[model samples]
Target: MVKEVNSQELSQILSNDKGRVVVDFYSTECPPCEALAPLLIELESLYSNDFSVYKINRQDNRELALELNVRSSPTLLFFDKSHEAGTRLSGTITVQQLIGAVVDAFQVEARTLIVPDAHENIWDVLILGAGPAGLAAAVYTARAGKKTLVLKGKAKSHLELAHLVENYPGLPPLSGKELLQNMETQAQGFGATIEMGDALDLTFGHDMKLVTTRTNVYKAKTIILAMGKGQHQQTIENEERLIGLGVSYCATCDGAFYRGKKVVVYGNDEEAMDDALMLKQLDCDVSFVSYCKSTQCSETLHESAKKKGIVYYPDARVTSLSGQATLESITIETEAGTKTLEAEAVFIIQSVPSKSLLRKTGINVESKDCIAIDKELRTNLPGIFAAGDITCGGLQVAVAVGEGVSSALSALKYLRQNS
Candidate 1:
């Protein structure tokens, strides 16, 4: 059994610890945390002498959560010799991943090594984003009998920020988060290994491409540059000053923290409507501010917002985002006059540009912002491919799905030809 510790006892325990320890900092309420708890207990029973597993309630220890800069719940911390030095797994993790982390953290041979197996150096496909497009690609690739790995970038997927997506086919008016959950589960169900991390840098050579994240480096024979645009930063006073304070891009990830609070969605695009609806679900007084001339939100989204009494401020440009230490309010420039709206959080949606990883790697982008590609979806770089918003197609879920399927087939053909 893993010993549960609180902040009051953490200092004392760390002071007396002799060997390796794994601190599972988790909240009882989170589903992913709950999913991991039993596995962790089993690991504790399996490695009693080599390591000790301890649980810390994040809610109980505000001081500890702050000290460790705990961003999300159910985070796992591995302390080799002392609690002061450690590595952490935030959000969700798998048994295999956790085992690998333990092996690396404790410098012990993984239990799996007991069985000798042939090392097959084959990663049939490597998709670099987890948005709808990337997820779609993984599903198709894995279904095609290829070993696939998906490296999820930040934004998780721009599709995820959307709150209500009535336009996505088959799924009847689902929240963006729920829709993304289905996509993720589908990809996972098809034997596609989804790794939660970012591909910080990408490089292509004659034979293979290398993607380096902060945690690890992955090599692939063929690469899909599905990493869509990193959100454009809102250049407002104190906006940069108060990033984690209240300003957030991910509603599902952070909406619960600001329950019943006032939040503003900045943008006139479909994603803005989606985010506004998510905030509304948290019982927050939601408002949508659009700088765009016309709001492109669907009828379902507009009706939903209207029924919820969420306000819409069109032709409004946020001149400044201000707060003392956290977000306080946003100043908007309108045709009438400059006005201020008090808000605890601001969701900047217009920053969703298309060029990202492909740009950095020198893949040709056209004037219309589509990645220059043939019908095959292969970029100028021979082994590098692109799909979804990264291409010149309109940013819609249906288009992304079709592009993803096309890209996967094209990549498979490329791999087979070279192999």
Candidate 2:
């Protein structure tokens, strides 16, 4: 069992304990923390004799959290014999990632307590993203009597953000949200399972694909890519080249790496402000750079930054990143003049397409940075298909729906021939 401890108790326990230790810093009303609670219980039950698991409430142990440089919820730290061990994991994490961390830190082989069999967890078709294309594919695949599942990404669909959609056949002018709702209901009526989650990693076997989320793993015989246009990639010079060196996309996942270091957060969304606040708590000098005008930013974020004493730059744009091998400083263009700030790290938060996953799985992409598909909507990889905006087709609801249907039919044919 995982025992809850306060700051005072934790200090004593860490100094005296000589066994393997894992402490979880979590918060109330955090969705990621809630998802991790059950996983921690499972881990404790399996490794109770080998290691002791403990939990600290960030709300109650704010001082301890500051000292430890833990800035985000659901942060996991590993220690062996009172000394830090292994790489720290934050944000949404997979079961495989947690187990790998334990094995690396303790040098012990870890196994899952409950193992699911192939027949129990495998689906006939698994679709990523819940946009118009994905939902349409689900309708076709499920109607063909195949078990279909759709994993809706955390990012909202571009179509859903539209206030009105004027041109579509067989229906009156309707709101984008209304059309999307109708499609979703149609897919569900045909017996498709839709779940909301983000895909963290993808692994492929000879005939199967594995998609790992923070809270669960999904296996399928065939897969479809219908994720919409990639999120805005950073336009600053050397930004892409410095991805893992000193540049990060997910602040919650990499905040600990820059503890106590000066960092710049370039975003205009709520997530960016949350990262700035978290970094401030870790005693790091943080600057909030909004690409939009000051009045355009969320009032709540603006007020929160003011109360926290974080430096704010309104209507600023990152022009370039400097440093040979790693990021050292950034040049920003403002209304007054160009200014360069010394920063050890930079965080650019935005939702991008799922192209990274495709690259990892050895799928071929076209010149336009999209998955290449044939007339039948089949990708170069067998049992895999591409559809919608991910294929670089015209950005229209009707086009996406047509591509989804074609891809589903091709997938059904492939399965039948192989069977």
Candidate 3:
């Protein structure tokens, strides 16, 4: 029921008062945009008398997009009385977010309105990530005869960026795209359904976990956290600019490449200690730096490092990572004095930021961004489990796969126990 409009048509549509106008500014080859189309159609179908839905291809209307300051795909702009009204929404959008905008724009009490229940069932297990971890989980869940759905996020997997991947066992050197394709096909062969979209909002305060995507409000019996690394509280200096240079998050993923080189592990937690040890095992000259004055790092881990002859600066904090094109050295502040450590790589392992959505949902988190889970991959929530980079677990494809399988098994067990 949504109308496709050019900028000229949109201008006229906006001039007349037809309640409130919901304009979707979208671009092609945009996953989130594709995910949003159905929802817009459904909204139009339900509330044609309340508001009108219109779509504009941003590519065909670059001038209009720029004029509106529309920088991202799937941006929803609400207009009333030939003027912009209410806040603008971009990226992944849910029916809740969309409908709320209408209610706010029109103030439903201003007139009689019919609202539709947005929640839809009934997926048994909903995996949030479509990377190696998510795909691996789907294989297990589907093979167990459980109805599993994996969401391929709007962010492309790093695998797709990888030109060549040789570490995966039994596989000859192949492109990451091919490897990912193979994994998807295998999981689908087992009857697992893979969806492409980003989760707009999540509701977990009740027994049935509700995940809202661009298309539907999903009701799932169990959920898995396989989304890639959580967003950091703040960007680190020169960090994003030097991602593949000398800065890294997952040691195991990039450790082997740095063997025999100097590397510093900057963290105060067990995960950080684990990275330091893993690097040491790979023959990297490892330096452990703690942001805290002393250390909550286990004495056992400290002693193990000492036994391995790995150096430590428990009271030091990284001040800067310097290198033009590649990482060259690390600067730190210590109780003794400011010092610089020569290093090829710096593995900065920090907790997931507290502002993460998972925290908003009251999921137990060990630190900033990463989810907390037991060995069995069970989250504090009864029907939720976590795996892969989301858990800050090694961050390697193999590690994600292993955790995905573990999470799937845990989900299956939870379902059976309850049934």
Candidate 4:
């Protein structure tokens, strides 16, 4: 007969056993649990002596279920030991997927893979943020068979500020949201659990780091902080008065309504090019006014602007804004002297890196306010890693994604040594 064990007994069973085991926290009333029952028995018969299977009914084993934090029925976990479970599947899982998971778990040594489940605490690595960096980390970590979770907030990302981003690799002229969503969807497809919420604070322990949010705290052996730069605002005198009315920072979010109208881009870097490219695509008469003498713009951007008939003005600095109630026009000091440019909306795209959170953690930073990290994306702290625009260079989405992936792999190696 199969063992009917409580949480304490199950804990003891794992601690004492050297052989592999499968435990299912289930309920008879749950249709999904009932559906998975036959599959569990099949796995037991298929693996034979190499594998052991156990079942804990949720109704009769309430304490065990509670202790393991099993909220839903039909949760299957492959047990390697008391302290570790290799594969965990919550909710209804397909028979083929369950078989694949079991095969992967028992064949760990042969396959050279050690993928962590959603419920497992002993992961090789955990990445923060679900943006380009975090999502990239998730893909690499999961494919490497390491446990990975991406903390994605419900709010939109900074990348979604552009109506159409033309410079990202592979796809050409894709909407920012569409591109970000594609990355997020691909990460989820690879078994990474994308949790929605912000990481409020972080603390480091002996072998693991703790991520505290408004709801719960998660422990990871290694962490990658891939949260990108924060939004930058212009400090023009009276600009704050007309916020949401005409003065805007996000062109993609508020650009469509101002179609065929005159708008001004108050930036001098690649971000300005990204913003102006989107506005120009919206059929809006977009003009680029730079605080810097020459713009460091993309080749496609320069060509696209010319093709779309967008105006470009170099060495134009905004001294102040003018309007009674709403935004009317901006007064600028150009090389030809002071000039007032009539516009309905102004988009601010400052290239300043936001590293206030990292600064609070005492991570060493560069003169440009980006966090300093080695080639492997390791910060001064042993278990902490940084990626994306928050780190040394590479402000592009693709580069940030590559950085996050490499950092996660390095973090996994670090975790394996300590764990």
Tens-digit lDDT track for model 2 on 89-195? 76555566678889998887878634223556788889987889999999999999999999987677778987888898989889989999999999999999999
How do the residues 1-419 of candidate 4 rate in per-residue lDDT, one tens digit apiece? 34567677777788898878888887643444543554566656666667788887665676666677664455777866544455677544544456667777776322222222225364456676677888888888877777778887533566777688888877889887888888888887888878865554454443445554434556677888876775343457677676545775545435554567789888766656777887787688888886665344534445655776777667677778778866788888887998888888887654212342343344687876677899888988887888887685667777888898788878878867766
Q: What lDDT does candidate 1 reach at residue 365? A: 88
Steric clash pairs (candidate 4): 115-145
Please say which candidate is ahead in lDDT: 1 or 2. Answer: 2
Q: Which candidate order results from sorting by lDDT in descending order?
A: 2, 3, 1, 4
Q: Which is superior by lDDT, 1 or 4?
A: 1
* Top TM-score hit: 2
Candidate 4, residue 129: lDDT = 68
RMSD for each of the candidates: 11.5, 7.7, 16.0, 19.8
Residue-pair clashes per candidate, as listed?
A: 2, 2, 5, 1
Model 4 worst lDDT run, 10 consecutive residues: 109-118
Number of the predicted model whose lDDT against the real structure is largest: 2
Off by over 4 Å in 4: 1-123, 231-356
- Residue-level lDDT of model 1, residues 346-413, one tens digit each, is 87654323343343355788975667888899988877789888785768878888888889999889
Whole-structure CA lDDT of model 4:
0.67
| Cα lDDT computed for each candidate against the true fold | 0.71, 0.79, 0.75, 0.67
List candidate 2 segments past 4 Å from native.
1-124, 142-149, 152-167, 191-200, 207-221, 280-283, 292-297, 307-309, 335-337, 353-357, 412-419
